[model samples]
Target: MAQNLVLIAGATGQIGASVARHVMDRSGWDLVGLSRRVQQHVPCPMLAVDLLDAEDCRRKLGGMQGVTHVVYAARYDHAGGELESVDINLQMLSNLLTAVKDRPDLRHIHVVHGTKYYGHNAGPGPVPYRENAPRSPRPVFYYAQQDFLIQQQGGQAWDWSISRPHTFCDLVLDEPRSITLLVAIYASMLKELGLPLRFPGTQLAFKSRTQFTWLPMLARSIEWMITDRTCANQAFNVVNGDAERWSALWPAIADYFDMACGDPEPERLARFPESHSDIWCDMVSLHGLRPSELSTVAQWAYGDYVFSPEWDVVSSMDKAREHGLTESIDTRQMWRDSFDFYRSHKIIP
Candidate 1:
C-alpha cells in the first residue's frame, strides 16, 4: 500500500545500510536491499545480487515490481592505491539500470559518489572542490559511471542525481573500511604496548585541512535530493560544513586515550595489524572484549590512504545548500561521538 518501493543497491555497505534506515524512517517507503552478501541485521528484505554478472542482475532485479526509486551505493571491489577498472565499474551500473529502468513507477535514481572524483587520491585538486570542477586528468570509474547514467537517462521518464561525499564517518563498529574503527583499533594496540599516541602520517598531512561527511546527514541529503524535484539531473557535493587539520585534533585524541601526544611519525598503517597481532590478541583477552581478529576489525590499507593525504581535501557545500539540502555536522564532535560509540559498544578497550 506504500506509495514508493525503493531498491537500495550495495545495501550492506555502510552508506547503503545507513541510507536504507533513514529513507524508511523519513518517508515510510517499502524497501529492498541489493548486495552480494545477505546481512541478517539489515532493516529490509535483501536480494543477494551479483552486479558484475549481467545475467544475475537480470534474474534478481529484472522483475522488481513497483520499484519506484534506486539508490545505487554499490562499488566494485578494488584495492587502495590501485587503478579501479572503469569498464567493470561502468558495467555494474549499466546492468542495474538495464534491469530496472523500465519499471512504470520508477521516479528517480540516486548515485553515491566520493571525493575521489575530484582526484584527492591521485594528489590534490583545487581547494574546496566545486561540483562543476573539470574531470580529473587521472582515469576513474566515477567519470565513466556518471557519464553512463546521463546517457541512459536521455529520454527516460525517470530522473537521476549524484552525491559526491568525502570520507564518510559513522559509529558502526564492525565496518571494515571505517576511519573511526581504524583509529580506535590502532590506539588500542599502541596503548597495549605502552606507547604514546603518535600522529601516524607526514607533518604535511597532519597539518592539512580535510573534511568528512557525517553518514547520517549524508543519508538525509540523499533522501532529500531524490524526492525533491529541483535536484534532478544534477550532481552535488555533500560534506560536513566545516574542515579541520589533524594537528588541531591529535591532542584531543591523545587526551581521549589518556596518552601523551607524540610528534608525527609517518607510518604505513597497513603494517600495523600484522606487526602487532600479538598485542591485539592480548588486549582482547585482557579486556574481555568481543572475539574478533584484528585484521577483520579494520582494513588498515584504508587507514594508510586516509592518513597519507598530504594535501588539503576540502569540498564545497555551497551547491548542496543552494539545492536546499542544508544539514551539517561538526567534524570534530562527529569524531568524538564515534569514538564514544565504539567505547560504549565495547568495540575498543
Candidate 2:
C-alpha cells in the first residue's frame, strides 16, 4: 500500500486546522500543512506558500512526493458585505492544483466550501438548501472554484469532493472568523458593561431559523469524503442537522454569561467593537484572561451578516447520511459546548 500523504491548504484557519488535527490523530496517513503564515504549533511540516502567486505555489508545492490527498481549504482575503473576487479565488485553487495534480499518488481532492454557494450571504436561499440546488445566479467565488475543479478533474485518476458547511462553529483559539468565539466575546463585553445581552440584529434575524456546522464534524465528514469512493465528484451539505432561531438560543446564551436577555435591537456589530476596546482590555487584566485584542478576536462584520439574515438558512443532511456519514449533533448543545470551550481557554471570563 502506498503511504497516504495529504496536503492541507490554509492549515492555520479554523477548517484547515481542525482537519489537520483530525488527520494527524488518525492512523495510516501523513500530513503537510500549507499556509501563507508560519504556524509553528501545527503538528506537521509547514509550507509557507502564497496560494495567490502561481509561481510561489509551484516553487513550493511542485516537488511534493507521495501526496495521495489534497484538502483545499484556503480562502482569499476579502472584506465582508461584498462579493469575494471570483478571479483571485479561482486563481488560488488553480495554482494549487497546477502544482500538485501531476502527482500520480494523488487519489482524492476535497474542497471545503460553504452555504454561500446557495447565495445565503446575499439573501435567503431556498429553504433547506440541497446539493442538487441550481447554481445561484450571483457571481460567487465558490462556483468558480467548483467549476474549475470539475473541468480540471476530467478523465483524471484523482477524484474530487466538496463539503458545503454553513456558519462554522470552531473552538480554536487562534481562529478569528469563528461565530462561536465572536458571540462569546460580544456577550462578555455586554456583561462587563452591565447591559443586558440584547439581540444585536433585527427582529427578522432573531426569528429566522439558522444552522451551524460544528468544525469537528466537518473535519470527520471531509475524511469520509476522501476515503469513500462513493463520494467522488459529489457535493454534500454538512451541517448540525438541526435548525434554530436566535430567539430560542439568545436566552440560553445570556444565562451562561449571567446576564439578562433583552429583546431584539438592531445595531451594526461591525461598529460595535470600535467603542469596546477598553472594556475588553479591562476584562483581560481583571480576569487574567488570554491577551487578545478585541479587533483580532472577532470579525464583527461577519456577526452583523449572520445576525441580520431574515430568511431561514438550512441544508439537508440526508444526502450525507444516505451516503454513509450518519453523524449528527444537537445545535443547542453545540452552542453550549462552544461557550464551555471559550471559558476553558480563557477567551472569555
Candidate 3:
C-alpha cells in the first residue's frame, strides 16, 4: 500500500485544527501542518511558513516529497475591502500551489470555504443557497482561489474539491471570532452581574432562521472529500442539516447557565462587551476561571456582525449527501456541547 501523507495548511485554525485532529488519529495516514505558529498539541511535523510570501512558501514547502493530499484551510481576512481580501488570499493560494505543483505523488486538494460566496457578508441574496446558485457580484476570495486552482490543475493528475460551511461553531480556546463562544461569554457575564441572558439583537434578527457547521462535522466531510472518488472536482455545502431561530434557541442557552432568557434588546456587541470588561474580570476572579480579559476572549465586532443580521442564512446540503457524505449535527446540541467544553476547559465560569 502506498503511504498517504496529507498537508494541512492553517493547521491552528478552527477548521484546520479539526482536520488535523481527525487525520491524526486515523490509521494508514501521515499528517503535516503548515502555519505561522506551531501548535504544541498537534503532534505532527509542522512548518512555520508565511504563505503570502511566494519565496517563503517555495523555500518551506517546495522540497516536501510524497505529499498525497493538500487541504487548504488557510484564510486571510482583510478589513480594507473585498478587492484587497481577494488579491491577498488569491496570492497566498497561488504561492502554495506553485511551490507544490511538482509533487507527482499528490492526488487530491480540498479547499474549505463558507457562505460568503453568496454575499452574506454584504447582505442577503437568497436563502438555502445551493451549490448551483449564481455567483455574487462581489469579489470573494473563494471564487478567486477556486478559479486559480482549476486553472493550475489543467493537465495535472491530481483533482480538487471544495467544501462550503457556514457559521463555524467549535471549542478552540484561543480563537476569538467564534460566535458560539461570544454568546457563552456574554451570557456568563450577565449571569455573574445578576442580569438575565438577554437577546442582544432586534426582533427581526431573533426570529431569522440560521444554520451552523460544527467543526468536527466539517472535518469529516473534508476527509470524505479527499478519500472518496465520487467527491472529486465537486463543490458541496457542508452544514449541520438543521436550522433554528434565536427566539427558540435563546432559552436553551439560558437554561445551560441557569439563568432566565430576556427579550431582544437591539444592542451592538461592539460596544456592549467593552463596556462590561470590569464585570467579566470580576467573574473570572470569583470563579477561578482562565485568566483572560474580555477583549482577548471575544471579538465584539464579530459578534455584532453575526447577531445583527436580520436576514435568514441557510445552505442546501443535497450535494454533499448525494456524494455519500451524509454527516449531520443538531444545532442546539452543538451549542450545548460547545458550552460544556468551554466550561470544562475553564474558558468561562
TM-score of each: 0.96, 0.95, 0.95
* Model 2 alpha-carbon drift over 4 Å, by segment: none
Stretches of model 3 off by over 4 angstroms after superposition: 39-41, 77-84
Clash total of candidate 3: 0
Rank all candidate structures by their lDDT, best first, as comma-separated numbers. 2, 1, 3
lDDT of each: 0.87, 0.89, 0.86
Winning candidate number (lDDT): 2
Model 2 C-alpha lDDT per residue in residues 116-136, reported as the tens digit of each score: 888887787678898989888
- Comparing 1 and 3 by lDDT, which wins? 1
Candidates in order: C-alpha RMSD to true structure: 1.4, 1.7, 1.8
Clashing pairs in 3: none
Instruction: Report the Cα lDDT for residue 183, model 3.
Output: 90
- Backbone clashes for every candidate come to 0, 0, 0
